[model samples]
Target: MFDLEQYLDMFLDESKEHLENLNRNLLKLEEDHSIETVNEIFRIAHTLKGMSSTMGFEKIATLTHKMENVLDDIRAGKLKITTAIIDLLFEGLDILDEFVKNIEAEGKESDRSIDNIINNLCNLNDVETTDSEKDSSSQLQDDFQYVTSIAQKAKDQGINCYEINVKLEESCILKAARAFLVFKAVEQNGEIIYSNPSTEDIEDENFSDNFNIIALTKLKKEDFKEKILAISEIKDVTIKDFDKDSINLDQVKNLTVNTGNKIQQNNEQNIESKNDQSESKQRKGKTSKTVRVDIDRLDNLMNLVSELIIVKTRLEDIDTDLKGQNMNEAIEYLERITTSLHDAVTKVRMVPIERVFNRFPRMVRDLSKELNKEINLIMEGEETEVDRTVIDEIGDPLIHLLRNSIDHGIETPEVRKSLGKSEVGTTKLIAYPDGNNVVIEVCDDGSGLNIEKIKKKALEKNIITKEQAEIMDDKEAAKLIFAPGFSTADKISDISGRGVGLDVVKTKIEALGGTVEIESEKNKGSKFIIRLPLTLAIIQALLVTVEDEKYAIPLNNIKEITSISTDNIRIVEGKEIVLYRGKTLPLINLGNVLDVERKSENNSKEIIVVIVKKGDKDLGLIVDNLIGQQEIVIKSLGKYLSGLSFIAGATILGNGSVALIIDTNSLFQREWYS
Candidate 1:
C-alpha cells in the first residue's frame, strides 16, 4: 500500500523545483527564443506533467499538460514566439507557485482558483498552425540515431550481433566511467537491449564494475574484437553470438566480497572460496537488484548511523584506557574502518548545489520585465555540494535576495544607459566550496546598497541612536537594511518591498548555521554572499564541561579557549565582562544558562573562557573546565525542545550519555537573562 501523505510531500518538493525551473527558463526562452532553449522548456514542462500525473495531482498535472501542449507547439514552430506567450507562461507559473504554497501549508495539493489561468492557456490553441507540426514520435532519442543508421548499412558487409562477455577485476575504482566507455564502444557495433544493472542506474552513476553485457552487430570475430585490452581497469572482453546457453553460469552465481581480515582465518577464507565455487544448481533467472529509496529516507538512515558512530567512538576510547593495549588496537582498527564507512554514507545525504541554482534565470527574466528593467543572471560553479538540510532552506532566502536585486538593485534601462552602463543589468548566482563551507553569491550590476538612505531610514525608524548612526561606517549601516520593515523604496512595489521583516531571512539563515554578508559600491550593484556548512549532521565540536555536565560547542564558532583570571573578568554596567586584548567581552556562565548548580565559588578555579564570534560581535562562554575533543554525531532534541532556540541539538557520548550542543547564535542572542 502506498502512503499518500508521504508521496504527496515528495511530489510537492519535486513540483516546487520543477516550477521554479519552468518560471526561470521560460523568461530566458522569451529573450533568446532559440530552438534549443525552447526544447529545454518543453522538456521541463513534460517532466513536471509526468511527475504530477504519477502522484495523482490532477489539477497541477492537467494545467501543466496544457502548458506542455503550448510548449510543444512552440517547439514544433506551429506557433510563433511572442511576448504574449511568455506573459501567459509567467502567469501560469505564478498560479502554480500559489498552488504549491497552499500544499506546503495544507500538506496536500491545493484547491487553487486556476480557472482563469487554464482558460488563458487554452486560448493559445487558436493560433494559426504551421507545417512544422510533425508527429511527436519523430523526436530525438538519447543515442544518436543517425550514427546508428550509418552503421546498420554495413550489416550486409559481414556484420552480425555478437554477445560480448566482460569480466572485471576486483578492487576497481571509477567503475561507472570505465563501464560507460565500454558501453559506448560496444554500442557502436550493436544495440544493447539489456544490461545487468539497467541503464538508469548507469546514467545516475550508481554501479560497480564486475560484469557487462553487449550485443554487437559488427561481429566478424576470428579473433576477439576491439581495444578492450587497452583499458586499464577491464580484465577481459570475450565476444560471441547472443546465445542463451553461452553464459558462464558459475561466474554469474558467485558474487561475493571480502574485507580481508585475518581473525576469521580459516572460516572466512573457506566461505570466500566456497562462494567462488559454482555448482550445477538451476539459476534464479538473473533478476536485477536495486532498492529505490527516497533521499529523505537516506537522511534518516544517516542520522541513525551518526549516533551509533559516536557511541562506537566513545566505547573504543574507554576500552583503550581501561582494557590494556592489545584489545584497544583491535577496537581502534574497527573504529577506523567504520568511521570512514560513515563518512562515505554521509556523502550520500548531500545534494548538488545545482539543484538550488538552476531555478533562477527565468525568475530574473520576468521580474525585470514587470519592473521595466534589464538584468542578466550569470551562474557559476553550481556543482558545489551542501547538506540536504541546507539545500531545503536555501531557496527562498536567495529568492528574496534576487527580487531585492531586480526591484531595488538595478535601475531602469533608460537610467542605466544614461549612466554609461549596459542597458541590461546583470544578476549573478555563484556557488563554490570554500573549505568546509559552501558559499552562495547573488550579485547584481545595479545600484549598490544605499548607505545614506539606509542610515537615514534606521534613525527615522529608531532602529539605531543618532550618535550610533553617525559613528557607524557605510558597511555597518548597510546591515540595518535587513532590519524588520526596512525598505528604501519610496512606495511599496509589488515585487520586492513588503512590510514583513526582511531580517527574518537573516534569522533563518543564521538558524541554519549560515551567515549572510552583503557588499556594495555606490551605483555598482549589491552582492549577497551566504556562507553555509557542507553538512549539519557531523561537525568538529569543542567539548567542554560545566558543573560536571559535558557540552558540545561547534568548532566553527570558537575563536580560541583561554584561561581567564578573576581580574580579567571585570564588571561593565554591573554585568560580568572579560577584558581581552583591550576589548570588553560579554561573558555568559554556562551553568547559569542551563540552570545547573555550580560546584566552586573561588575566583582562582581557572575558567575555560571560550571566545565565540557571531558575525562582528563576540562573547565569552565561561565553563568550569574543558574536555578533550572527539568526533560526535549530532542528534535532534525532538519535540520536547521545540522552541528551545539556544540548544541547537544533543549528541551521544561514548559512555551513552547525551551532551547538549549549544546554538552559539541563540546563546549569544541571550545575555541579559543569562
Candidate 2:
C-alpha cells in the first residue's frame, strides 16, 4: 500500500547521485583500471539496480543489472579490462542515464530500446564465462566448492545448514519487496550463504514465484518453515538439509540458463515492483547529516532578512532622533547582530561548486574523442562555494565555455605534434573565491586566439567597421568573437560554427550580475575569466543621486570616485569623454540615461564621476551627489518591470524609499554608447 509518488523525489535524487558516481568512476576506470575503481563502480551499479528495481523502473534495473554482471566478471578477473570493454560500459551507463532522465521527466522510463546495450553486455558476460580460463563446468564446480566450504564451516561451528525454498502467490505484486522482507526475516535469525537464480536476480524480480536460499542456522526445518509461512502472501515454504550430496551441478546450470527466460517473461508482463516504505525509511536513516531544504524555504528566509533590514533602518532613525548615547549603543549592538545573521544566512545559501564541476570531465572525455583531439581537463578549487541560486545557473555557461574551448581552442593531436607541442592539449577549469565574488577561469594550452583571423572574420561578417578594425588592438580584436553571429570557423559544424556560444556566455553571465573577459596571446593560449557575485540577494552598494532620483551601484564594480572640472570634459566622436590617468574615459550622464527630472541646472565647477569597470573597460557615470554606501537587499522588479535596460533590480533605502540598482555590465555595451 506504499505510495510511489511520495518517494519520487528521493528516487530521482539518488538516481542522479548514482549516475554521477558511475560517470566519475568510469572515467577513472578508463584511465587507471584499478580494482578499487572497479569495485566502486560495481557497488554503484548494484545499488542503482536495487533502487531502480524497487521503484519499478524495469529498463533502468535491467540495464544496471547487466552492468553489474560485467563489472562482477571484471572484478573476478574472468574478463580483462580493455578499451572495448570500457567503451561498452560507458555506453551502458549512457543508456541508464537516459532512462533515469526519462523517468525523472515523465514519471516513467522512455520506450527507447535498451535491447542493444543489454545484448552487448550479455555477449561480453557470455564471453567471460564461456571463454575464460575456467570453463562453465569449472565455474559451477567453484560455486559448489565454495558452498561446500561454507557448509562445512557451519557444521563445525555447531550450526545446521538448510536450503529454504520460498514461494509467493502467483498473483503477488511487488515480488522484490516481498523477497526483501523474506530475506530480512531469515537473516535476523541466520546468515544466507547462497540463493538459486542468484540474489541479484531475486532482488531485481527476475525470477518466478519460487526461489531457494541456503541458510546456516540452529533452527529446525519445521521452525524455519513456520516462521516464513507466518508472513502474508506465502503460497508455500519448504526446507531441506544442505550437504555436498544435495549439490546438483546440472540443476544449478539449468537454473542459471533459465534466468534470462524468466527476465524476458517478467518484462513481457511489465511487472513493476511496488515501493517499500520500510526500506525507504531505512535509507533515510542512513543518509548523510544534511537536510535538503526546499529552495522556497531559503527564499522565505531571505525575505525575512529583508524585513529585518526595515527594522534596522527604523532603529537607526530612532537613534538619530533620540540623540542619546544609549540609543546609539543599542543601534550598534543591533547592527552587529544583524550583520552576523546576514553572514549566517549567506553561508546557508552557499553550496560547493563541485556539483557543476563534476560533470565536465565526462564531457571533456566525450568531446576529445569526438573531435579526435587529445585533451586533459584539469579542474581545481571545486570546493569553492557560491550561492545556491548562482550554482543552479552557472553550470550551463561553464559548459558552453568548456565546449567552446575544446572545439575552437584546443588543437588536434597531429596538429599539436606538428606545432612542436605535446600531443595532449590541456584545458583547465579553475575556480576560486575572490573577495565578495567567485572567479572561474577556463583556460586552454593550445593555439591561442588569432587576432588577425578574428579581425578578418569580423570584417567579413560586418560585425566591425573596417575603420574600427584597423584601429583595434590585439586585445580588442580578440573580443570580437563574443559579438553575436561572429565566428572564425572555416566550416559549420554541430559544435561551434553557428557563433551562438560565447555571446550566450556573455549574456547569461551578465544576467547573473557577473562579467566575462578573455585573455589571449597569439601562438600561446587563451583563458576566459568569469567573475560572479557570491550572492544575488544582498550586497554593499554605493547609493548615488541623479537629480531627485536615487540609484544603487554595486560596490564591487566601482573602481574609484573622483571629481573632474567641467573644462576637463571634451566632446569626442559625439560622446562626452574625459582623460583620467592618461586614458580616455567615456562619460555617461546618469540623469539622462534614467530620464530623471532636472529640477534645476547645476552651476557647480566640478562634476562628481563614479568610475565603474566591466572586464578591462571602464566608464564614468556622472551623478548629482554621493550618499556613501549601504548594505542593501536586492528585490526583483518582477516580470512586469523585467528586461528594463540599465536597471538590474530595486532596493529599499533606509528612509523607506525605493532606489533602482544599476546594471553596470550593461553599460559597457556598444549600444549604450551609441
Using lDDT as the measure, the top candidate is 2
**Which regions of candidate 1 are displaced past 4 Å?**
1-28, 36-77, 93-123, 127-292, 319-321, 497-500, 671-674
Residue-level lDDT of model 2, residues 1-674, one tens digit each, is 87888888899888898889999999999889887788788889988988887788888888888888888777656788998889998898788888888888899998999899889889877776676545777876765666677667667756778878899999999887788888888865666766777776776579999988887666788888888888889899989988678768875653322122222222222122224435545777888558887788988998998778767876776545566887788788888888888899989999999999999999999998899888899999999999998989989989988887888888888888888999999999999999999999999987888788888888888888989988998888878888887788898787884234888888889889999888887657789999999999989999899977889999999999999999998997789998899998999998888888889898899999999998789999999999888888899999999979889999987778899999988888845463
Model 2 off-target regions past 4 Å? Answer: 132-135, 147-175, 182-193, 204-287, 323-326, 497-500, 670-674
User: Highest TM-score, which number?
Assistant: 2
True-structure Cα RMSD, model 1 = 14.7
Per-model C-alpha lDDT, please? Answer: 0.70, 0.83
| TM-score, prediction 1 | 0.70
Instruction: Give the Cα error of residue 143 in candidate 1, in Å.
Output: 27
